[model samples]
Target: MSKTKFMGSIGRIFIASFLLCLAVVVIYPLLWMVMNGFKSNGDMLSSPFSWPRELNWQNYVKAWNRGVSSYLTISILVTVTSTLTTILISAWAAYGLTRVAIPFNRLMTTLVLGGLMLAPAVALVPLVKLFQALGLYNTYWALLILYTAFRIPFCTFLIRSYMLDLPREVDEAAEMDGASPAATFWRVILPMCRPIIVSAVVLNVLFTWNEYLFAMVFTSGGDFQTLPVGLTSLMSKNGTDYPVVFAGMVIAAIPVVVLFFASQRYFIRGLADGMGK
Candidate 1:
């Protein structure tokens, strides 16, 4: 091959090697967590890297009994509810902002985008008070609202950017056929925006699933604590049970990791479309 082609091929190999190494780095912790979850407390601390000669499935049972099972259910509820609302509300808002021209559209978009700049830490106090007054404090509703509100700006931005890349011809054609804006959005726009929607849904799932701060603060007690918050309490109460803690961590990670792998294609497509434009 010519020098140029040879250099290009070498670059490709280097990029592939870097990516493979990156994947290993990212996945190693998860692999270790899974392995340790099958180990006894002594084995976990004794040989952290080496595989066990005998698998101890009892760690998972102990972890489950020590609150992981309940925490997992709570995490699933919060993640699913928060993600669904975030996507629906944000997608509708984005489609409206991009397609429907109203007065001060730019100002509205800026205001919404400005939400992205505000740190959640700054709003935590007021959010707590607001939820308390609204009687939503320390409940799934509190978590759902907080997660949805916090996630809106990014989701709106992503969905809006993706919608911009969609062909305007589809909208015009739908309009010419006497389709209303709502119909056009639902029938024509939504289908085309599926990739971004999937990406947004997955992103929101990851966030809401793994969230600890808000879940810790907004929820004080009762049936309100999410997986992260619950896991912390579980760990504190069972600090000596290293295997159980590892198992709980693994359980907490499994759903989001599985969902990410399942939706990775659409996630990548959405990211590419949103960023490429």
Candidate 2:
């Protein structure tokens, strides 16, 4: 074989090996956690690495009865509401920034994108005061509002980047057909931006589902807790029930994992397309 061909083969082998190792590293812990959920506390303690002798589904039942069900419901509600709100607002903002000739366009873009710089931690104190005064504290609206607000900047940045790469002729064509600005956006641009929109939805869903800090702080426990915070509470309350805790965690992780895998093609393509621009 030629020297260049030999080196190319070596490079491909090296990359494949590296990726195999990375996949194992990422997947093992999740598999272990799932296995642990099927174990009893004693079994897990005795043989952390061994397969469960018998799949004890009772742990999952106990977890569900103990509060995982309620937490799961709340999480789904918040994730869905926040994701929809964030995407709609972000898509509109991106369309305006890219397609519309709004006043102070550059300044508007700067201010909207500038939100990425503001850390969520820094706003916690003021947000608490504001929410309490507005009677939104300890309510679902608080989570809904915060999740949408914080996520909009990043989502907008992604959609806007993707929109910027779209051909301006589409806009002109839509206008020539006597479509209004809103009609053009809905019919032409938004449809063309499907990849990025799906990407943004997946990303936002992941964030809203897994988000703990705001979920914990904004809502008092019981009915309002999301999966992350609820998992912590489950751990604390059931510290001795390790298997149940594991089960709760497994339950929490399943949706996001499934969602990502289901939409992975669009997710990767959207990110690549957006970033390429």
Candidate 3:
């Protein structure tokens, strides 16, 4: 073989091996969690690495009955509401910044970008006080509003980048057909933005679903707490049962994992193209 061809093959092999190792590093802990969740506490303590002698599905049942079910519902509700609202508001903001001819547009854009710099930790104390003052504390709306508000800046940045790269001919063509600006945005631009929209939605879902601090602080425990907070509560209740605790974790993780895999293509493309362009 030619020297160049041989070098290229070696490079491909190296990249493939590196990716395989990375995948194993990411997936192994999940595998261990699943395996150990079925084992008895004694088995997990003594032979943690080994598969259970018998599958203990009851662990899942106990975990679910303990609050995983309610937690899952709360998580779903907050994730869906927050993701949709964040994407919609961000997409509209992006469209306005890219398509409109408003004064001080650059200043507005900078202000939106400034939100990305604010640390959630820094805002937590004031947010708690504000929510309590507004009587929104211990409510689902508290989480929904927090997730949407904090995420909009990053989402708008992604979408605005993607929108700036779009062909202008489509907008002109729609305008010649007498389409209003709102219609052009709703019907033409949004349809074309499917990849980034899906990407942003998936990203928002993962963030809101896994968020813990706000969920723990904003909501009084019980039906209102999301999966993360509820899972922590489960840990306290099942302090001695490691298997059951693991089962709760596995249950908590499945939805986000499914969402990521289902939209893996759009998620990667949206993030890459949104920034790359």
TM-score of each: 0.95, 0.97, 0.96
lDDT of predicted model 2: 0.93
Q: Which stretches of candidate 1 lie over 4 Å from their true place?
A: 237-239
For residues 1-277, write the lDDT of model 2, one tens digit per residue: 9999999999999999999999999999999999999999999999988999999999999999998999999999999989999999999999999999989999999999999999999999999999999999999999999999999999999999999999999999999999999999889999999999999999999889988899989986546989898877766643578889999999998899899999999999999999788
- Compared with the true structure, model 3 gives a TM-score of 0.96
Tens-place lDDT per residue, model 1, 215-235, is 999887777777888877765
Model 3 lDDT at residue 264: 91
Model 2 residue runs over 4 Å out of place are: 237-239
Per-residue alpha-carbon lDDT of model 3 for 81-171, expressed as tens digits? Answer: 8998999999999999998788899999999989999999999999999999998989888999999999999999989999999999999
Locate the minimum summed-lDDT window of 10 residues in model 3.
231-240
- Alpha-carbon RMSD to native, per candidate: 1.6, 1.1, 1.4
What does the lDDT come to for candidate 3? 0.91
Error (Å) of candidate 2 at residue 90 is 0.5
Error of 1 at 143 (Å): 0.7
TM-score of 2: 0.97
